[model samples]
Target: MQHLSVARPARAILLGSAGLLLSGCSLFQSSAPQAPLPASATLPDATISYTLTGQGSMPVVFQSDLGDGKDAWDSVLPLAEQQYRVLAYDRPGYGASRKTATPRDPCTIAAQQHAMLAQAGVKPPYVLVGHGMGGLYQYVYARLYPQEVAGLVLLDPTHPDHWRRMQSDAPTSAMAIKARRKLMFTSIETVEFDAQAQCLQHIDLKTPLRMPTMLLVRDKFGIEELGSVETLVRSQEKDWQRMTGAPAIERITGAGHYIQKDNPVIVNEAIKMVVKKK
Candidate 1:
């Protein structure tokens, strides 16, 4: 396994409140537009939107983190598309996609993804790349249709055990819980969050991930800005260790939760490696 080296900057912590606001702003901000692709995949539920680019026998499918759209992967797509077909889609209620009445559980969301890909005529044997919460969806998809997945590259993914083990006393955890409660009655994100919470509750972490897998862990915990959610960080690390048969397990320094944005080369390289394995 090849490890990519990145330069770490001097440690300086942002105030917790300011960090949250800045992160939220960065996540929702529109990225500069890329040249439009000629074709887009529109599912029967016309609300789901997706774009497919590049060309190869085994396609690279990207799933973005929560509160983010397909555009989040734009910087990484150029090189990925150069060698293989890349498909990035906005999940329901994000980007060009509109809200759906369907339950947002992992199984339901995975099913929708399957239907969308099928409708769009994109065949399986996909190299799956997922970030943050998107990783859970990919894992569920692989479990539901094991034969369809060629490999997986999970970028600082959320562990199924996160919510359960998270220290409620921690400032970050408290903020998260508070936000979850507020969103529950006010926004669609709450519905999705609930679905993820439910899925995590029953997820069988012991199940083997048979496909070639690569897990990238961020080296910096950003404790200065986010308070010490030590338990949460440790839980994620434990989850990474559970991928016993994985081909690559890397600790990426100089990056945070949004590893792809901080270092697209690492993500793109991982995708390329997985594609070669297939």
Candidate 2:
């Protein structure tokens, strides 16, 4: 299997304790750190250390962006736990979880995570939440195993189309992608990239996941330049329309690439709505 290589920068939310402030995801930690491990009943690969808070039937499994671990959604968990069972963990190789030698492509990651969830006895009727790169994984997961997934929440996910577009004609743009990849590697380790396998695999959500999908996103790129917020909004608006189609989409104000940290309330509400849906 071809390995995937990606570099994600470390993002942390910094503000006084007044308003709700979500923390950065902890991407790197040695096995020596002695973090709390998942229940022993989980599969060997799923034996990741994570914080599980909340209560409910439809368990919400949150996947963090490149390198980020469970802490990424610290603030939001309190509220989320109040309604649904919130489960977030470090993907293999990043946090306290055991690293894997296999490629970290969408299918591989999704399958492995699914296995882990099963081993841990976290049954489906699940509400999957993914931030940034995590969003991409959840998308693939729903496509691969739609019956298990109940809903999806994507927080400013990186568009696979955008990456492909940059790689084709824009050498300069590709450089930016490369730079981001480098940053991701430095912050975390043992990640793989299979460009061939991951290049927009005909995701027709119209099939299995008739469930609600809430995309709480910020404009990552617009036209040529990073573009103004307006441009980003318009650009995201078009993509959002195409992506969600029948599903509802909400555009939150004042959020950046990391929508969860930007405003936990928005993230919480989006997850709440999707999980609450009958």
Root-mean-square deviation of each candidate, in angstroms? 4.7, 9.2
Report the lDDT of model 1 for residue 79: 69
Candidate 1 local lDDT, 1-278, one digit each (tens):
68865644323232111111112111212243345464445665546788887767878889876666788786677767776778899888888888877888887878888888887788988888887778778887887778999999887676665554554436665566556457533355567655675654455567678888878766655554344564456555666657425755687777666666666777777887777776
What's each prediction's TM-score? 0.83, 0.74
- The lDDT for every candidate, in the order shown, is 0.67, 0.59
Give the per-residue Cα lDDT of candidate 1 at 214.
79
Worst 10 residues of 2 by lDDT: 14-23
Top TM-score model: 1
Candidate 1: where are CA atoms >4 Å away? 8-34, 38-46, 167-172, 180-186, 200-203, 224-228
